[model samples]
Target: MPWILAPRRHRVAAGVAAVLLAACTSVPLPPERPAPVEEVRPTVPHPPAANAVERARSRWVPVDWTELPGWNDDRIAEVWPALRASCGRPAPGWAEVCARAMLEPPADDGTARAWLARWLQPWRVEAPDGQVDGLATGYFEPLVEAVRQPRGEFRVPLYGPPAPGTMAKPGWTRQQFDTLPAAKAALRGREIAWVADPLDALLLQVQGSGRLALTEADGSRRLVRLAFAGHNEQPYKSVGRWLVERGELTLDTASWPAIRAWARRNPQRVQEMLWANPRVVFFREEPLPDPSIGPRGAQGVPLVPGRSIAVDAGSIPYGTPVWLDTTEPLSATPLRRLVVAQDTGSAIVGAVRADYFWGWGADAEAQAGRMKQPLRLWALWPRGARPQ
Candidate 1:
């Protein structure tokens, strides 16, 4: 497979103010608590102070570069791919910056850093309650085993959406995966691939995309990536929170590993847990060009392992350069870096909300599944663009 050069057109909407609608829905959210501090990042190394906190509106507060922790140390050049990808479809107020960036690549790390400082301004987003810190999580492309068709150990089917008008409604609930005749009939001949573990199927759907190792009849294996296509258009419910609410698991013990362990122990209750989230995501298979690059995010660009982030589309438009200030999943070590808002998720909402894109494999999964940390974001907008 070859690395694809695809253009991502970011459709911009009104700024972070629109995310208030999330409160009306049942999106799974972490408890509100002050962020645990294990690392205190140094502020701008050479700060003469060029920015300040402006008035607050719907939780977005304009702050100067001096306030962005670790802003001066970020390897802005490393995220060029992420920047270039969004340049293909630069959003409102971003065309000039994206255009300048595409005209020539940065000369060096220092030059890249200079370019960002010269052309962009940073704005710190806060929550509605005037809190600068908010929840953050991690998402990644899962690696799993699958077959071209149903085989000995592969019985579960991962499907694409039924043809237009084939579905009984615009969307199908989780129960429709097996119950609804239209839903079952619609996917009869549309199996993307047959994965061995039902748990893998559940996670792929939740994560919205992944890569699969396909075993041919002769035993040769090849890796193919699954990208999000469409969904059953149903609302999402969190099984973890459901378990917590039902007294089946405590909030402290609701990590993915724990959930899977419980699933194994109570196989009979697995279906009940699986269907707790009525949202059923569909996928489209694509070529996996390189092991290093991740799948294209909602911004329509390939994600850069540790430098890409998924954010609430309402809170932060795709293609916006963000000075991410957060901690590593468990260690609380500073994970500060420059990341692009290239993706979005159902569970991702609010002004300062983000979901860090952590590449793939067991290590990535472990990090992603355990991540739920305090987050603060600084959107680096083009200096010459309209105020965000």
Candidate 2:
């Protein structure tokens, strides 16, 4: 999470363009039939397929179902919830396809695979330079115990945005918010809750959203979600990268646990480490009606653990099903699967990069912290539908 910026913002690149999928690592279909031409709504015009490869932020090369690595092995039914959730707010070219998805909820793996094959076309995602290889990182919601007000060891405050008429265009940096009297006064009454650890607050901010187990004044407990509301609008910096540059840690050893261990060893410098990243994210508290539901992503849909991915909006539109070809973190175990581009991150740019959402809790934190791996992608667009 420290490596990626907030997942709340949508930062699509300007001037939408399409790139071609690299042929080097792909299994091409026979030339007898060309890839199906995507049909988009008249409002979102598409360049002719012939010229697609020549210009664009990213490109797509249609590949056969067999070309997607481990396409047949995934437990397709596991993706149903995420798929259905995406349909709640279908992308521009997905209304018809989403309608079918909602009407025919596949009950099993085989059925799901067949349904996808019938309605979607898998297109390899590539950079304009035809580069297919990219990086895949991981992020997750951090669940932390908290109190309604600051008390005992719970001193760090989690804030909501300042009132509409009280804030400036660009807000204060983390350092200023902590030390400047004027900046601190601006946020005096905006604290939504308080927590004991600064790192936990940092985690929630970095992930852009998380679940908080709140302890009320009456001693009753309720779980709530703190979703990304707004930010200071300052640039985000990576604390992990900061430690690596300072020789306190190496790139390979700069995981979240490692960072925390370093913080414990140098308690006096914890504030310094936190200040490395000037960005501070504010939150809006929402009721956790269902524990199974994750925080809403930039797409405005609840994310599904292991089934939701944050991608570059310019590279793959939100709600698009993606065939991710990547190995497990720090190992060679194959982790290919079908996921929806239900979210996006500031650092999740380029044609092939993605941030996999691992969900909430301890195990999720561990997995996400270590998940920087090589990746390749295939976007499954609705048949006869083009990228918007």
Candidate 3:
């Protein structure tokens, strides 16, 4: 986890926005029904953590089912896949529940809720100081164009990791890779694909993985998936924050669009913009087994959009079933639901803090960009199970 600074952080351009059901191709999904307008709550940040040990950062407060917001409102069926995925690699204290789940899985919302209630207990997540509210952000899969060879517009190379111990100790920084002869030699023949926009390439590195829409020499298009291979081990710095610190953009205005616009206006500084984050990620090509499945997460399973969440793995393990209470992206309407701890991120570093996976495509991008709100979480632990 090189502070990718993954699978969730990079935001792509809207023109290429669409989900790839498979690695090399996909069919356009039907338009989704428009969401009804609803009142939304304002996003607020939680209090800063005091200097305390990891144990004191979060505490579980036992609560009944009724305590969860919108406990029964979610289409629990959507959650079943993510949870079932977790069954393959259950976190500590989750084996029994996951085994039970595998033996007799739920088929519908009613059945799913009933099943969860019978076997799992909802424990409200909070800090030792009883601070429940925490920061809630959004992340999405960026679909972009690429080429197999470095021809014309596709010049920037997306790389695979060099052999272990290739670079001295922690390896070279992102800025040093292209200029250093040794670094270039080490990365020789490591390209998985090439893309036109350097920003798009950087986004893929930042996001850890993405769908690459390719332009074949035969004048045909193909899509492929790039999974995280490794990183340079350099520290990740936020380019957005870097710009903000230099008074180029405000916190509210430092998004993908804004960042790119600023880059275009100042072309000479584009390299500087990129070099701001020294943590360069490498990628590997992966096969698409199931069209319906997305990329694997920290939980060692596919993630479910709107149902999969990235949390601080220190507080919640990868396979924990959590009931999250938050607002819809860019809306105050409560977006409470059952989510699986399928992934982790560098920035996601608190007990109640979460990064909501908005899935793939245009709709997901729209939602993920504007989503920074307050959140509360309740981990659904196995009945009679306690933290050891």
lDDT against the true structure, per candidate, is 0.66, 0.73, 0.68
Model 2, range 67-110, lDDT digits (tens) per residue? Answer: 89899899987887777777877788898998888789787999
Give the clash count for each candidate.
1, 6, 5
lDDT winner among the candidates?
A: 2
Pairs of residues at least 3 apart in sequence or in different chains that clash in candidate 2: 17-56, 18-56, 19-58, 19-59, 20-59, 39-384
Report the number of the highest-TM-score candidate: 2
Winner of 2 and 3 under lDDT: 2
In candidate 1, what are the lDDT values of residues 16-91, reduced to their tens digit?
1111101111111111111211222223322222343332332444566788898778777777877787777678
Q: Give the TM-score of candidate 2.
A: 0.86
Q: Candidate 3 on 228-268: residue-level lDDT in tens? A: 76677787677766787898987666565677788889989
Instruction: Write the number of the candidate with greater TM-score, choosing between 2 and 3.
Output: 2
Residue 174 of model 2 has an lDDT of 96
RMSD of each: 9.2, 10.8, 7.6
Which ranges of candidate 2 are over 4 A from the true structure? Answer: 1-55
Lowest summed-lDDT stretch of 10 residues in model 1? 1-10
Among all windows of ten consecutive residues in candidate 2, which has the lowest summed lDDT?
Answer: 28-37
